[model samples]
Target: MRILVTGVTGRLGQLVARRLLESGHELIGIDRRPWDDAPAGIEMHSVDLRKRAAEDVFRKSHPQVVVHMATVTHLIERSEERYRINLGGTRVVFENARACGAEHVIFVGRHTYYGAAADSPLYHKEEEPPMAMTAFPELADLVAADLYACTALWRYPELCTTVLRMVYTLGPTGQGTLATFIRGPHVPTVLGFDPLFHFMHEEDVAAAICLSIERRIRGVYNVSGPQPVPLSVLIRATGRTQVPLPELLFRAALGRFGLPRLPPGALTHIKFPIVVDSAAFRAATGFQHQIDEAGAMGEYRDAFPAL
Candidate 1:
């Protein structure tokens, strides 16, 4: 099968691209950043998804499978630019896919769209309406992007669309939300709160994406790996010192001592869990995580030892 993957330069994107290539599929990548060392035989196009050039790639390649994972997931970028890339870029990807007559489109999304709150269910289902925009305003664009991709399901019934809401990822790159939070010498936690953190090994995440494509699964699903573990256990597994700080102190201490400068609303996330049920995804794809929580944490620790 001919597959076109957006955000092919991203960590997760690279993993999925390589896996698909290994499976003997024709691979083409689109990303604003150049993959200078992209493996042989995988065609790569350095182009922004929101530009007409991106559409040209879709028209010329005429790929049968489209994997859209080009949205910004970090908070470091300007809000307006982030919104444009996350939401606007998503709109363009779907439009181009449909216009180009693609068979299946997969949108890789974050499970954080469920949001963290005292009232949230222990395990969120795919049908639950998104609440991340309400709890963390910074994530509004991401939620919108996910919802927009979901609309493709009914709006364009002829196109097989799969929306995957993936949990946090931990891997050797040490580049995701979970990695950054625990990368510093001292990992902070809200006082009297030990929320369960749900995450997956990067390899398993890539495998899940590949399985979805190979099986041509459709509809929205929550993708997770292993079981949920307390924040303290996760910190200990990563070989980092856990520092329990009051909510006020935690909020004030952002951007200091190697800590990430998160928005104020992110505090609620640390205090409450946002776990999801992946039974639907597993049933659909027969997906099982190859790496357990301990193994995933150990890989990160081996890649970047405690400071």
Candidate 2:
């Protein structure tokens, strides 16, 4: 299948594009600018999605599936930029995909839709309603925009549309919380025991995406790995001693120095246990996480020596 990957310049996008290629798919990778070094045997297109003419690029490629990974993914800082890039960019993709007559579009969403509470039941199905918006106003907006992006497909059921609500993915860039601790100025930890959290390796995330495109499954599905790992276990896995600090105290101390507070839903995230259920996705494609929590931690440590 000929696949078009937007945001091919990003870490996740690049990995997904690479995985698809490894699986013998033709790819047309589009980014705002050229990659530092283009991948072998793949076509690259430099087209700014913000520009109206960019739609023609997709139209010309005429891919069978579009793995829409491009977005302003960061939840903290750059609110205006995130809104413009994610909200605007996603809308543009949906409109362009439909116009180009692409057969399938898969959106990569986050698990924030589950809210911050740690005990919150892991979301496995779209039938499991999103938590009512409460705290995390900024995140609420981001999540809302993501949901809005998904809704565009509702208008075009004839098109195979899917939304993959992915959880914290751990990999090379070391952006996720687990990665942060492994290569941290200091490992940040919450007091009164840690909460359960879910993660998937970057490779698996890319694979699941490739599989979804290959199978052309439609509708929303929560994508995550096996059992959620506890925070303490994560710390041990990293071979780092976490400095136990009360959440309120830590935030207050950081606030005193005028450091930006964690994003709206973040505190709720560490306090609550979240396990995204991907059984439906597994059933559809027989996908399983290649790296579990401990294995993922080991990978991060090896990639960036644990202090």
| Model 2 per-residue lDDT tens digits across residues 1-307 | 8888988888888888888888899988888868878778688888788786678788888888888877665555546777777778888888888888888998888776766654456444566656625656566555765687678667877678988888778866676544543355345566885777788788887888888987888888888875778877776776666666787776665433333345535566656665777778788778888887777777776776655
Model 2 scores a TM of: 0.90
lDDT of 2: 0.73
Per model, state how many residue pairs clash.
0, 5
Residue range 1-307, candidate 1, lDDT tens digits: 9999999999999999999999999999999999999999789999989888999999999999999999898865448999999999999999999999999999999999999999999999999999887868989999999999999999999999999999999999887888887888788888999999999999999999999998899899999999989999999988899989888889888888777677877888899999999999999989989999999999999998997
Best by lDDT: 1
In order of appearance, the predictions have TM-scores of: 0.98, 0.90
- For model 1, the superposed segments whose C-alpha errors exceed 4 Å read none
lDDT of all predictions, in order shown? 0.92, 0.73
